[model samples]
Target chain A: MNWKRLAPPLAVLVLWQAGSTAGLIPGFKLPSPLQVLGGLADLALRGMPPGHRLHVHVLYSLERVLWGYGLAVLVAVPLGILMGWSRRVRDWIEPLVEILRPIPPLAWIPIAILWFGIGIRSAAFIIFLGAFFPVLLNTVSGVRSIDPLLIEAAQMLNAGRRFIFLKVLLPGSVPSILTGMRIGIGIGWMSLVAAEFTGVRQGYGLGYMIMTARDIQRPDEILAGMLVIGLIGLGIDGGLRLAERRLVRWR
Target chain B: MALHLEIEAIQKVYPSESPEGRVEVFHRIDLSVDPGQFVSIVGPSGCGKTTLLRIVAGLEARTSGRILLDGRESEERDRRIGMVFQDYALFPWRTAVRNIEIGLEIQGMPQQKRRSLAMKYVRVFGLEGFADKYPKELSGGMKQRVAIARTLVANPEVVLMDEPFGSLDSQTRNRLQDFLLRIWRERKDTILFVTHNVDEAVYLSDRIAVLSPRPAAVCGIFDVALERPRDRTGPEANRIRKEILELLHRPHTSPVTF
Candidate 1:
């Protein structure tokens, strides 16, 4: 609906198309926008390796992300709350977290393959490593940043320990937790794609399709796959932002 | 049922980085509120009026003190006591009626029963249409009303208010003051209100306890013998306000600890 937003991208695409048609940009190194569109149509209709369709690749990638991100949330949120609420827990766990968090998730690929093998488990583990710290740290900061007066007010209202944790602490930290989730998902999605680039037993992933396109010397398909990955990331982030708006309408 | 509240020999000391290595915020701060009485603690800013209220509410630990509710030494966090804060302290995530229901929910009241009871207060507080609105959506006055309603729905025998109307504009403050008086008249809950506003203290309290500056003690206690719906600018109210102001402005003397 906003023409202003559409105009810049349109202009770039037109310039790119013109450059490709004039041979200023080589096809094998960089495909034109039209060639990328043709590649996309080929992926949807004819599949990447004859039988592995684009939709199947998308579904597999989504499944991996969901599994990894879900597990990260389940483990991180509770741990974060405990770490935030108890000084002893924080003191014990913070050092381990600090030591591990700096290691890139992609760097864990070889170790993860050794541990879980070349299946979905290794990929999920890599994605989990990518997602976990953001969720945990955000949740911790969220809980810690809550107004002490709110806790005091809850105490004055005779809220017991459980009530304070569930009602006051949990709800208070939601905004931060959501922000963490958004960041975690972004990183997890990226890690999943990169993890798939090494190898996938299922032969179905956006990253695998891109790698195969490179092997077959189809720059157009590679560009098309990259665009798909970016669009999916945008969609995932947009979905999270919508959920955040609903959850924190008070903000 | 309202309970008499006694704050006896309350002391608060904070470890400090100064040469003394400790700061005594207040010591031997003693005050008492009769059953169904409205008492205000007025003092200069930073005189520990809020700290005193926090101690009474059992939200802060005192170095040494006893808070007696109806002659019994209350527990660390007495269910019979509740507090309203200057910032309202309403759960921003909760709607008005839900915020009002928080204490009841903590008491393990049945959901339907608590909802109906909270609705009654929503109507009583004239927050009828705004019952489903979150604190952020409400005006400053409405948020305070929700905070007050939240505390009152649980029917706390002793209500500790620490500058509950401090953040509002003068007009909203006056309106809320009147609204609070109306609620007090209806409920007759024992209230210990803290404020820096001398006029507010005079206009609302049955008794005003003036605290001296830091390491504070009750410097003076004045009974406001004014009748209900008393004029804010009346001779009696003005006279009491002026006396309290003068007491606040006086140079601090070493507090006498009992």
Candidate 2:
């Protein structure tokens, strides 16, 4: 709500509106904000390329990211906590995780396709790998950074290890977990684009629509698609930030 | 509500820089605390006062020792042991009240009882308005008070504080010292306080045990014998401080090992 923060984006929007109105950009290459909004409405009402609406594309991408990101949190967080808490766990998994972590999410797309075929499952697999390492690494770092005195205090109170994990460890790691989630979401968003371009079908993700527009030489529509993607990503990031502020009220 | 503690021939040794040697921190330490006694251990930095306190708290295992509570072995006793750290150690994610209730919650006290007991300590510490506040929102002194309250809220038989006021500013530390003295007077719980501050040791403790530096051992024990409701600025307080400082300044080489 701070006007200072809103200034830069507002200025950019005004400039974009002015440039498009003055015909400063080639019509074939760029679309105005108004044009993109109109295109968005058209896409919503009349569907994209064929019979699928914008909601269908969004829902398709959302479902894949949700399942993939959910699985990553489920598997990675506990493993990360264990590794962070014990040197033995870290010794066993750290090298393997470090090796796998450097391989780009896009690099996994071919392997994912080979393993799951070109479908929602393959896209989900790519997104899962994209999201997993960040969350795991962050959770481990978060747990590691916790004050040893806090653990001792909990122990003095006779809180068992299980209670300590639930009551102290999880809540303490939340800020880092949220950071990892934000990073994972960004990675998932980028990975989804590469995932859809690899000849996947029946899934109406925006990445697929954008690629189709590029093939058809409709660059303005492609620009519109890209704009929509950016805005949604911004919106989701903003929503997560708000949620982080509320849930981590203590911090 | 009162209990006795016996410490019999405790020792702690750490690996020395030389691979072939071990440095003894404390050797053949012996002490006893009568029911409701308040004792403080004071020494220079790296004196292992904290190490000894940790051993008594059962947070650290002594190299060799026997700790008895109420005439029974500490391992077999069901006495509640509470600790307050120098950092306050309040769970940042929990509210003041919840942090206080953590010990009782761990004891599996019913939620209603935990809340009720937590509320009592919260009010007792004059933290009524800050019950829902997080550690970040509270000042350092307030956080320390909450930490003390949290440790006492479980109705622990003995409280172990390792330099609890060492992290506070001078004025805040002084205020908390008075607050702690008032609480000990009213609650009558056994307390073992560790600090390098001779003044603090004299002000709060019924007895002050001076510890030698690193490879530490008890150098001397002096009973303050200052009357109850001891004042920081009073003449009696000054006398005790002088004695404790004298003990702390006395030099000693390696302790005689068995």
Highest-scoring model, DockQ: 1
Model 1 chain B weakest 10-residue run by lDDT = B74-83
True contacts kept of each: 0.85, 0.90
Candidate topping TM-score: 1
Candidate 2 chain B minimal-lDDT segment of 10 residues? B73-82
Model 2: native contacts recovered, as a fraction: 0.90
Candidate 2: residue A155 Cα off by (Å): 0.7
* lDDT per residue as tens, model 1, B1-258: 999999999999999998999999997888999999999999888989988998887777899989999899966677788889999989999999999999999889999999999999999999989999999899999999999999998889999898999999999999999999999999999999999999899999999999998889999999999998989999988998888888888777756789
Stretches > 4 Å off in candidate 2: A2-25, A31-38, B76-79, B231-235, B253-258
* TM-score of the second chain for every model: 0.96, 0.92
CA displacement after TM-score superposition, residue B134 of candidate 1 (Å): 0.8
- Worst 10 contiguous positions by lDDT, candidate 1 chain A: A42-51
